[model samples]
Target chain A: MTTQTTAQAPARVRLTQLTRGQTARLDSADFKDDSAAHLTAMGLRPSCQLRVCKAGQPCIVHVDGHAGGCRIALSRDLAASLYVLPH
Target chain B: MPPVTLPTNPVSVTVAIRTAALVGNPNVGKSTLFNTLAGLRQKTANFPGTTQEAHLAQVQSPAGPIVLADLPGAYGLSLNTNESRICKGVLTGDQSIKGFPGGKPDAVAIVVDATNVPRNLRLAGEVIALGLPTIVVVTMTDAAARKGIKIDAEKFEAALGCPVVFASGKTGKGVADVLPALARAKVAAGPLSAAHIDEWADAVYAKACTAETRDHDAVTDRLDLAFTHPILGVATFAAIMTGLFWAIFSLATIPMDAIEAGFGWLAGLVSNTLPAGAIRDLLADGVIAGVGGTLVFLPQIVLLFFLIALLEQTGYLARAAFVIDRLLKPFGLPGHAFVPLLSGHACAIPAIMSARAIPDFRQRVATILAIPFMSCSARIPVYVLLTQILFPESTMLQAVAFTGCYVLGAAAGLFTAIIARRTILKGKSPAMALELPRYQWPSLLGATKTAAARGWLFVRKAGTVILAISVILWWLSAYPKPADPDDAQRAAEVSFLGRIGGAVQPVFAPMGADRQLTVGILASFAAREVFVSTMAVQIAGTDDAEGEGVRERLTEATRDDGTKVFTPATSWAMLVFFVLAIQCLPTLVVTAKEAGGWKWAALQAGWMTGVAYVAATIVYGVASAIG
Candidate 1:
């Protein structure tokens, strides 16, 4: 199932590859209840640009423009689930 | 019909003040705070159908009596996983799991870690939006201070328009003042204010917090360099795991030997004291020999739990999870599944229960099914016996082979998960959105306490369920004795159980398991250690020469053809088979209940058994061919 990449593609791709210091914009709808709810609760939305601040095995992404920039660690599976486009 | 005029009486009624549920992300020191308020006066019961316990305690407040329920530490009140669902249900009064059927808490104590204020506040903000009377308890203030971080607690409280408590659970500093304050606080019960947390992010920070410095970036950089390095991170994870396994094997031996010696002594004492009778035979053979045989390995199991608990408490487990997550992603499992899968190495019951962390139903089920494939501690005695018999000449090689069996079990679990995901459990792999709490030194006292408590529970279970089953098995093998006392050995060969074993012999013949082995297999279904005792009993009954002990009886036993029965190849195959098989009834029962019914459990057992049979058959066939 090939799908179009959103502006968050870079961030999502970096997450999938476990590459750090990359940024991307993710489509909110690409997320399921579990992922979406967690992301939304963590303040990561469709238009919000997130930076892959720390990506190793368990990657940490920094959601920019938030109070003191929220940092979240994304497991490889979660990184793959997110559809992102280059920001 | 006209209603008669009633006297207008203003009757005063006392309404019970509803509870305030404390919920938050993991490692926020919420549990410590909960324990402080609840003290030893708390009731610990499993959340319905789940192994996770719901701790309930009632505290008398000046306002009224208030119930304090400490829900599981969860990121959000969203039904992504089983734990989260339980948390959500408890928060919203969903009544999905009826253990907390008294409706939702009147208020919510959103515990936040002051050290990581941003991430913690995110969860706190979400809880506040749930329309519950929210009290934000900023825990770990001491830890934050140690890290050179400071926050204005009262300012944060005013910003959120909720009572905020700066409490240190470790020292009980500032903790005594929280409950009294909560009791006196007015119920701001109304629909939750529509606080768009994202929009007010900067405003909230400016109003609530004051950072001392930008020095955290340097620490973060160093951590990122070490932990997030592709090569270094993987190597560190491998080293950690190797150490874990090595510790499990080496540390367990001393205690395991002690337990075995104690049981052997008890067995000898019982046999010497009691006159030849059914009760003596039952006590010596069934209780002391059978149940005691199983208890001998309890130390190893407890040690394994101790190490795991230490790792978990120290926050190394989350790092391990992250490492495994990266590796397992290609295999269609989320990283969150790693802990559960790792837990499976010790036992599948807890592992299966721990699958509550996996959000997607398909992923969770896959993890659960795969758990039994991990070489659980229950299989250790069987494996040890077989391995000893097989590699009698080489202890080092035997140890290596034992380790190999564990690796093989893990491989099998992974293989099965892949197949199940592609076939029966087909679905998109769930996303793993997890919070990695900062690394902390593990509390030795806490780890010891947890390990002791868990070990005691296990001993209690063995005493009851395992003891009963062993007695029943003894009866099954002992009764309907052969007619001739002079030819007792031949009589046993013709008795009811002997006949049954003989009948089933052909089925396992290909696997090099004869009638005696068949009987051992039957006894193992009750408890795996019974395999050892059953063999001991069989050897004792067949030998005419007076043997001083069970070990000597076993060592001296010969097949009908005058050859040693415990051959290297046969023993190794048996060990391999037991290590892979799902034979424990209690495990099956737990699996059945966890899976929501008996049918799924049956299917799981059937598949595992089939796999064990085929694998054992192949091992035996190849070994015999090579020999």
Candidate 2:
């Protein structure tokens, strides 16, 4: 789940599939409009790089690029909604 | 009539003192800045029709006295939330909103966290779109610098078309510059378009903000790793809550005893100084005793709030909430419910108020509904009395039973929450999305100030209601005095409360509660602890005996049929009843206010009483069958 793409583009996986300490780029989120908007407000916008600090029912992530490297914690359902490509 | 016109204000009327509002995303050090600026000259009031509160204070600036309104933090003013509504209302000068000092604030202070500039800018952009005089305060610049991020103040100000100041609320650096910056605050020539605000903010960040590709605090990462671990995090929460309650109990005892003794002395003085009459009794027992009883809980309330504020300031409470979210989500409650649910052990009035922190309306109501079942400290005396009767000789069994009461009560609360969520309060449980702010040293002064404010609020709101109920209860129990006046038992038999108890006795007869026990139960509706004193008064004619003597007398009391009242079955039933009952009047009043309706309170009382009755009846029947 934390595999690196050696010679090809990174394969997109659900955020929950990433292990702790793995870095991934957010692809897109599959949430209702309000939930998706809230996620974006909290700095989880598509194309931002997220480093998983703790991944599980509630995952702790350090987001960079779109956000100013702020840490956010997302519930399991929310994490599952997020599609990320691991680096 | 055609010539009638209003006179213009005199030139001396002075341009009405400008009003400004502070807006920001949560956990952006906005509160610290407000506290630093406003100091002790602030008042907190709820926005009209909502439990959400805003702080307003007068801040003296070179421009003049600027009235500062601190709006609740919101991620987006357009979001469908109480906080966002209030924020937008105040900014738009909604006359319906009561917290704003002026119709519309003359200026806005948009607070952004330097460490999280882009996300903070999202909110800032939303605020700037209002086209009001605005200033962007970049807080925690020190924290950002520590994380290897830099912000060019001039570039940021140029990009946003407003004044920008870098300030650290903790170290007090650049804080002084904020007041002066407010004087030069300017409105944007044009508002940022809502549709392209994201691109605008991102472009601004790309130009004015720089990062050295640094890890966002390795220490914080390690802390989060352990704090958010499923197993370790839960254990940590358990240990912390256990310690919190233990500290509240142990630390509050000294002050509580002092308050009780002081009130007792005052009551004794009043009784000795006054002539024998209803006035003397009222003063000695009704007003003074009522106020004293309510104030005696101040220490616990203060300590609880103080410690919670400290934990919140240190940024640990969010992690705690994250850890507890999964455990509670299944029951239709959110992680934010943890504080209120846990605080219920100390007292339910404050716990109910704390539920304001819960963002979801359904979850907040569900949490409030379940809080009363947490076995508040008021129920401890009843628990002790019943456990003693159930196992008189074995101290160990009594201890086990006492602990079981708490566990059983918690179980009842959680199950009740689940049932309520599934049926009445059904809605989508929003997925948790809490920001884990960087760990910082907690401010003792800030925590103390918060605790003091909340403690006073409790006294002002709950105190008046509790005192009124106490006086009413006292009047009910003391009236219709017999001709002998000194004949306590005869007076009780003729009193309105006693008569009602006698009538209700038949209803409780199946559970083995006689007229005397029924009277105690009726009186305890005012407070759970009143049961012990009512029984002592009804049986022994003195409600002041030490624990052992009182228990001994109650254990041997006989029913009208000469059967023992404190038999195993009866004692067990009483224990179950006390555990599940909603027996606090002050709690109901508070619940009504905090939950925004009396119907919720009515539902709470009705449901809890029904559950207690049915559960107690079952226990009585089962225990008697076994015997």
Candidate 3:
């Protein structure tokens, strides 16, 4: 077997850019002082992952493993205010 | 800072405590909880600037006298929707808007459904964030237990740093504890720290929520499959509506007949006992006939309310909204507007008030404007008379045509709503965020009590306003009697009101209504049902010995040119016009009160009258052409 080399990670982008069905690994403190307070109250936190279920108009995001993953509906304006790191 | 000590009173002093505001999401048993706390002392009044009324009551608690205001249920304080904004302003002491005209509450009793803790907690978190003293009253605990959902109240209270009371409004269990807890509580001066809420939400969910081993996915999937299916859902909605209207018509006929018979018998008894003078004529023609005609509709109104209440309680109303939302979108109305529009068919007053459920300003206005277009039950008497005159030989066809009048009215309402929304009431359609409450077997007692209370209120209003108008109409047609029995017909034609109708008759000649019908239409402006009574009085005044009833006299009415006045074309056009017209003064007054001023009501009335004039003109033109 040929030896494999590790690749460098891409730069972090805004949380709102995450596409539908994509999961994000976020830092809880990144959301602490930001507009992410709403997201955190909805069970999205640092070290927690969220899957984007829908990405248009009123975006629907699913929080992983909390109460069988609750669906959070956010207006486009509110969704654009979030920031998250890609997994 | 110094620690101050207060002097003790010589005698025992009891300070009266103020009332608490009950706040919660829609359908979380807040109303039931308010009923428990207030009991029979409850009073409801309309909220300022909005038609939605908040219920208030005084509670005599052991601590002191506390009053409770049942604020309209809302989802979140952050949302800008009308209902949510009202709740937010009340809770946050931001009363710039006049929708809620009271001061902020001393404390809030936050109601939550224990069965749906996750969704309920979201609302609780928002309320707690307001920094007011709050007690979480977890309702539906009994339902939750049956559904295998367990909530640890202690854990929840510890997490939120507030008291949590487990209560069931249905069973009245643990409800007494809420007021006492609220009586002794002090409100926090500032909002909960954002850091604290984050920690609290995470800890509470982690500790209180247990992993579900059973799969509910299948159940939800099947429900979605059926409920959201376009073909089946629309079919089911149509079938249900058809059945409801059919039952309203069929079931109400028995009581209506009984009421009519009772009134006729009373009229006969009074006529035989008293002399044939003004008093006898007033009692028989004015009071009995007028009041009886209005009261005869009570059974139908009550039956309609009963079905609506049952549908609301069983949560089927949401599905209706879901279906109608798609259908009504093109009409420039939201889906939830369906309830208000449907309620308008019974009465525009309640229908206008119900428009508060719509969040967007434009949508609400559109709904309000369209409500008067619905063929309210007030128009039924006029339609029946016109149909009888037009289709005397075909009763079944007339009945069908009467129903078609209702359909035509609804179409006119939808068309107007669309035009208004596109021009004057233009705005983006608000997002649909309605929660689908779980279906339950509707309570028979609850439905009956609601229907009875509403029906009685309608009768009370009729007694006050309609009774006064009927007596006035009778008085107007009674005076200036013919000088002689030989010249009676000529004198009637020369009477002041008869001259008025005759002057107006030329204006309505194109529509084929003679002076008698013209007078009826003019009288209906004061009260819609007066059309029937006005015609009766006019017919009775003209003929001396015929002794024929108003219905028979109307059948023999003819125009000045000796042609039948009640032709199918003219009668149908008149029926259609009444169905489309905004003719009730009381409805206009109520609309003014609900809409915050006379300007909006005037605009609505003027536009609706114009629409009626144009539509009636078209109908008359086409029908005359065809005939």
Indicate the docking level reached by candidate 1.
acceptable
Q: Per-residue lDDT for A39 in model 2?
A: 80
Candidate 2's residue-wise lDDT over B1-627, tens digit each? 111111121112123437888999998989889988988998787677776777888889888888888899888888877788889998888833454565778888999998788788788878877867778999988777776888888777777777888887777888888877777777653223777666767777876888875665678888888888889989988998888889899989999999999999999999999998999999888888778877888899999989988888889988999888877878899899998998998888888988988988889989999999998988998998889888999999999999999998999999999999999999788878888877888999999999998998878864577778888888988988889877676777778889988999989878878888898899999788889888887777776745678789888987768888789999999999999999988888878877778998999999999999999999999999999
Clashing pairs in 1: A6-A85, A7-A85, A8-A25, A8-A84, A8-A85, A9-A84, A9-A85, A10-A85, A10-A86
lDDT of each: 0.67, 0.83, 0.68
Candidate 3: how large is its RMSD?
A: 7.4
Extract clashing residue pairs from model 3.
A15-A83, A15-A84, A27-A46, A28-A46, B19-B67, B325-B335
Among all windows of 10 consecutive residues in model 2 chain B, the one with the lowest summed lDDT is B2-11
DockQ for candidate 1: 0.31
Q: Where does the lowest 10-residue lDDT sum fall in candidate 3 chain B?
A: B1-10
TM-score of each: 0.79, 0.92, 0.78
lDDT (Cα, tens digit) per residue for candidate 1, span B1-627: 112121122122233445777788777888878877776566655666554567778776667667788888776555365667778777777743333447777667778877667656656655666666666778877666665667787666656666778887766888876765564333332213324444443344556676654323445545645665678877876677678767766787788889888888888898899987788889987788767866765775577667777887765555556666767776667666876787677667666765765656677777887888898777776677667666667999889988988999888888878888899888777555555455667877666755675677567767887788778777777777667654555645665777888899899877778788887787677566567756765766643222336555565567767776666567767877787778776667657656656776887788888888899889888888888
For every candidate in turn, the CA RMSD to the true structure comes to 7.5, 6.3, 7.4
Docking class of 2: medium
